[model samples]
Target: MLTITNVTWLDLLCLTGVGVYLVKQVLIKKNPAPYPPGPRGWPLIGNVLDMPRIKPWLTFAEWGQKYGDITHIEVLGRHIIVLNSTKTALKMMDSKSTFYSGRPVIPMVGELVGWKDSLPFLPYGDRFRQQRKNLHRVIGSRAAADVYNEIEEVETRRFLKRVLAKPDQLQEHIRHTAGAIILCISHGYEVKENNDPFIDLADRAVFNLSQATVLGAFMVDILPFMVKVPVWFHGAGFKRTARKWRETLEEMVSAPHKLVKDQMVAGTAPVSFTSTLLEGSHVSAEEDHAVKWSAFSLYAGGADATVSATYSFFLAMTLFPDVQKKAQAEIDAVVGPDRLPTFADRDSLPYTEALVKEVLRWNVVVPTGFAHCVTEDDIHDGYYIPKGTLIMPNIWFMLNDSRTYANPEQFNPERFLAKNGKEPETEPRTMCFGFGRRICPGVSNSHQLTNSLHLANAAIWISIAMSLAAFDISKVVENGVEITPEVEPLPGTISHPKPFKCSISPRSATVLELIEQDANHLVHDNTL
Candidate 1:
């Protein structure tokens, strides 16, 4: 019925094409589910300006209160899905792991700093699976409990000696202890001093990586093409920084690996993760590459996280003197003051064990836990989640969920205790380590003990029990005034208590004598 004589045939064809495109768009919109609700943002920027650079987890948690458990936001058109509840995270990240375990590509952290090789940032694929297998074979929960038990005990004793000698440098001593343990297990290398060069290099590299991966920290991360800009160009300092970071990262990954290889050739290699993997008869060059990077991954992030948790334990003790007193009382009743607490005393010291779990919950390390990306488009609870969407489990929110724990902000270990005053029925490891395939490989190795109270938690549990039995972490007294330590933690991916002053003193002369005896025995045994 339309008259086409007034218009050219080409123009009519164009009009018809436009009509078809509009109809298709409408059909497509009607077919797909809607994205999860989030704060509306302007076009193009898409919540980029609204994203908090520091302690973003808090913001996400607050948003979860307004929105549902699953909240979606976009940063410069990149889809971000935050899981605020344990149930949702478990369902999505754990039950549907295959479709949700991919790691988002961070140009600055992955491409520039060379962290793409690390297992934590590696994409979900065959290589990632192989690396995980190798890591689990060495440091998995069962393996860590079996092989590293005695080593953890010796290292804990050495750590006590360092703390006894320099109580003022408690955090430093904790760092040294964690570094020593990981170095020994990963490369069969001993960290003889707190200032070991390898430790220094690893620390610097991790710091750089953490800074680079902060959301919205680097422009190039969002605008990947900016990486092509010359280093000399104005505002291209990020390029220069990345180059320097690459050097440190390369050394962190390769230096210790080369050392192990050299020792293997010289017939002096110790039985370590690297040596075991390298000595295997069927190991290929590809497998060697996987092992090398996998081992370094253990050494790179392990020490810092351990140190952070330890510091949090100290901070908790300082703030809650009553909690400290209760834990110490339990340790005394179970282990007695004759010797330091050991793995053998774990079962008898239920309250002390509860304290360790509480510390992990109080100030979660890696709050918005390592982001997992989706491998394909999926519908979750009627909400459409497109492929490559970044999925972050709000660990802090889950740990502090008021529905799960009453008075969530208070530092209380009693929440974990069973109604009958027995061991905790439910451990917090699920929330602490993470969910599904992307869960921390070191979860079982990092914490959580078998019924035997093995080495997995020996470093932290023993240190905590022994320290409580030996020292009183009280408010610092300057002159006659008591300076209350602040309980607030610093905002970061791995949060630690802000610098706080507290007095660490032996409980009594008898306790000091016991500490001295233990130190003498460690030195006599050449364990330190």
Candidate 2:
């Protein structure tokens, strides 16, 4: 009887183990929803080899055409969802923003290079909200137009002078102008020259950060366990690079902020974004920290983006002289040649306004809208999207959709104009800025002021109008040969036209005189 009981007990234990295995299998098969269709990739690597190192957006756009608006792929176990259509992006990133606002953890850029504090890469959480709130408080659409208009105007006038002095270095002048504007507004520290230390450090930091963020650039980003390896270990060059980058990033964030605080203490700080935040009523330590990083974030990307758009404008002007002529005509009729274009003149130049929209759409600054992360498992259009998926909105694909804009590839501003020859009822702000809660906080300020018709648009608009009003951009003539400018843009997250030669000359001696007059007499109230 004892032997029989022992055998029975052993059998029962074996049966129990089998029962658990069967139950697990059932659970796994219960919710087997199909993943969104994508190009067939290798087993293990799973599209890792298929990813493009440069201009990945172009490939993603092509895939969107083949696989549909919502395409999914995997790279070494990580899920990536590309939203190709504006309608789908709005539905997911806009309508269900809460679930899609989370940012993916970029080990190389965010963790190694120490950019986690930057608002752009911050994950969806209380800290992100705090940083964003502080950013909006200082530079929000309403506050920017009211507070930073003078600085923008003064810097832009300086820009005109720089371009007038050296027409060949138009790109350099635009970059310097962008840097100067952000520096003045953010730190109350004027950029004395094009090679200001602050600007140099910031530029270096941005360049390194951009390179690091490129997918597949660093092996550790794909296999995060490699982060545990020592810097002295073999094949660990990225670790040393990250260390140097971190130091530069820290100085970029802290140095200017410290200067503003020191100036405030000396009672000589200029009225600026940092000054306002630091001197605000009843500020706590946490809030002050938030403000410092938020201000740094603004200075970091603001100039780069503005520079790219302006460069595109120059490219557009060179390629399409007709657009330039019409725009100049409009600017002359509204502001005239005596004075440069101003924010108040924005409304009067409808064609100029349409040109701004066209520039944004023609070659978007960020073709792939910054990636967002999924916080929880979700399903859309009968496709399964697991939690922690990386979401990339293909802004290039959506902007170039032929259905939405007729002849999308053509650089025509009339697409944004109505039948009545006025601004269209619906503009493509979403394509330019992004979607949902993670949308660019600076979009409002970048485009225009709130509820102000005088300045239908913001700094870029004023700069473009004034540029057209003042200068005639045409093809460069070398040895009696008209060098046709190529409109091909460099490949990166923030793209600009490849270096092209163009002849930029004042429309008239009167325009040059006006630029000089404004440059000399523009009063900058640096006093707080």
Candidate 3:
């Protein structure tokens, strides 16, 4: 009934969108090859209603069980291919990485929340390559990663002190230490023992990120055009929320950068990833922006994974006392209680090293990984994968796949150690950090176990080793009843173990001296 004169721009836009949607569906061409098998979805909406809202990796694993490894589905005319096995993910993402490395257009987190500038969300192009180059200069290899070993030792020793002082607040201490170490390495700014502004800002922004990146949480992600709607419009509350989060994200990204720049101007900026990069003769705007976000990405890269894995290590120790005792024995045999374990002692403590691997495998920090957008149309494994298809890897299921590990659910460090005639299971590093070009810049793809200490989590390894040597982690006895924590990880893009009580105390009265060993000094000076 409305004529052009009566039609508002919003009305016209909605009409055009509906027309386009219908036409696109009607004009769809036949496929060259059949899609990989998946549960059948209804017409028009396709699998929109079938998408799992919580713990999607478990659902993806079921699809894998029924339909084989590579399962495919369509939502709103878009292709979403899920990989349930390491073999399929590696074959395509590794072999055909040229196009498989592209990132999907995440409207909520990427565009609206302003994380599109981040390395993980950047599409495969010059900008992505430039950012990768920046990260590689600092942590490209294990040797490159080792340059910050001093930082790791200092922060970890501090972590041990905080843990001894307040054992019940273990998670807080782990997060604080991770933030301190990453901040020092990324921006050369040290965190205060009490509340620090940058850390607080980052924590808020990161929690927002965890909420924002959840698949299907925001409708704008599924329908990109929704971003065009006004914030005041009904059902546009997500727009306002995204705007607030974006502001927090921008502050977190820019504040430390401005500090580094100010220090550089005053000639007092200590050596750091940001300081080192901005030391150039002349800086362009694009390069400066890349440096700012990449440095934030460094903290983002390390803090969550480190905190999750380290906390899970404590949880595993609480539940599996025999494993804890065995690891303690290994630490005791290799490095005496008189001195704390150092990175130099890592190789000597193979059992502890295996324990670290088990921590990564068991916790499964990132369950369902970031989706890789296919940049070109192609055929893979007899499947017709078109351009713009999002390939999601089910990392949790892959790590837990019964075919790969002996008892996937059990917290057994011995799985990695070869005994009587059996070799260790497949190295989970290949699956955990991701595959191909989009692999996390923090982790090393090295074939050696010693080099498994990623630039992001090398501190985690040292912290675990030092903690085992310095303290005894066990179940808490309350009201004469020992509390055994459950094996459950919270749902999110980055999974964290549910809070559980545990007892942490010095192994002996003498170990207190080791905890107070001037963490700010020693290790850094020896290397310097």
Candidate 4:
């Protein structure tokens, strides 16, 4: 039935069909990777619209629930992987640290903060390792512990004074004392009272840093190509703000460095982080100056973290009297009313230790923490994570995960205590600093020593001195309405409560004398 033209058409059709089948098989073999489960979203803007601008931590947690422990999403062509479980975070971010330790290049933090040089935000490479080595040499766990006596002395005295004189501004006092201690150690400066130069500078620096990291700033980071367009033509406010922040931060950080260096040359400098850097620079002056920004990174990082934690401690004490009573009782039973607790007593004070962990869990200061970027391709649970993926270990969710803690909502210290009231069981809370190889290197010694010796006991003493002794830290109610704690914290990578009122008083005559004596002996360091 076929004619000459029909015979040719039949031959062409058979060849075309064979070609199609071969191409399909080749494509399948070339790309046989699987992605983690995630909510389906439009191309080039996956889940961006769904993400909450503020409190993205809560939103991320919800997504983790909808998706599995490891969820993948795309924002403006960039891939992000959120680690919801501790096991996965530790396994990938820790065990395979070389791949997950680098930080994402956020425009606000990187461009504005000179992050090409900032240690915390720097990528995982030789430069980062060098900077981290410097930090370890100067303020590593062991060295941090060594510096605790000064931290304890300064913070403790300030707490005692605040309990005796100004209770309303206790929050500021606590913040100032903790901040000033880090400032002094980092730059050889102490803020004895309000309006100290160092304190003012640090406050402004934090504000600018926070403003640069808020949700608004991320708009530019998410769409960096917009930044390539002329500011006058495209007309976005991101460029202007980014420039201002860079200049402000440089001025704030550079001025202090110059002042400290000058003081050292003029023979008036005390032992400080800057001084240590300078001394070490003599061995490798060129390299050290190149990474001098690392020193400022420590100041900025250590200052705010400690301050945030202490402020939360105050809030916790104000809200939960029973928690305070138990901690104070432990402090009293171990050290008695005559003397203060120290780092040596940490093992003996199990309840106090539990309270510190509970505070960290209750109000997570750095909820999402700083973002970490994947350096290479990796696999977790049969899914492929490509290189350059932004890995966020959902620290807030891990701490509050109901599966781990019995009642995650309430601020209960007893959760960390032993069930039978014996020596206590395994600590329920995980590391608040971070996980794996990148876990906060400062934690083991300097940070821990400072908290254990002065800050922790200082908070307990302040709680006992003010709440138990003078003021009632119970909730305030007015006009037939119970006023919940007003914590309109300045939005940033970190947060603290807004100012509120709480009653203050002295518990007894014996306690009152000890407070007064302690305050008198703690001299204003400026006049020293």
Tens digits of per-residue lDDT for model 4, 1-528: 854334442243344335544654576343236878887765334556665567777777998899979988865446788888777877887778878887777776677445446666767777777767666654554434345454556466556567568776766776677666666666676666766766766766766766666543455576554456455543455677667667767776777778888897898987666776675436466565644676666666666666677677767776787987777677667777665555457678777777777877877766776678888787777888888898887878888888777778898877777777554422433445666545553443222443333223333333333333323355555776765676555567766556666544555566667666644455433211
- Cα deviation at 117, candidate 4, in Å, is 2.2
Over the stretch 349-460, how does candidate 2's per-residue lDDT look in tens digits?
8889889889988878778877899998888878898889999988887888886778888988888778775545336665666777776655542224234311113667
Tell me how many residue pairs clash in candidate 2: 0
Clashing pairs in 1: none
On lDDT, the stronger of 1 and 3 is: 3
- In order of appearance, the predictions have TM-scores of 0.89, 0.90, 0.94, 0.83
Error of 4 at 248 (Å): 2.7
Worst 10 residues of 2 by lDDT: 447-456
Question: Per-residue lDDT tens digits of candidate 1, residues 405-489?
Answer: 7788898898888867555534666777677887765554222335323222446676777778778888888999999878776
| lDDT-better candidate, 1 vs 2 | 2
Q: 372-450, model 3: which lDDT tens digit per residue?
A: 9999998997889999999999999999999999989888889999999999988777788788888876665533435
Candidate 3 clashes between residue pairs 3 or more apart in a chain or in different chains? none
Better of 1 and 4 by lDDT: 1
Q: Cα RMSD (Å) between model 2 and the true structure?
A: 8.5
Model 3: how far residue 526 lies from native, Å: 12
RMSD of 4: 9.8
Candidate 2: list runs displaced more than 4 Å. 1-32, 280-283, 420-426, 445-457, 518-520, 525-528
* lDDT of model 3, residue 268: 91
Q: Rank the candidates by lDDT, best first.
A: 3, 2, 1, 4
lDDT of 1: 0.77
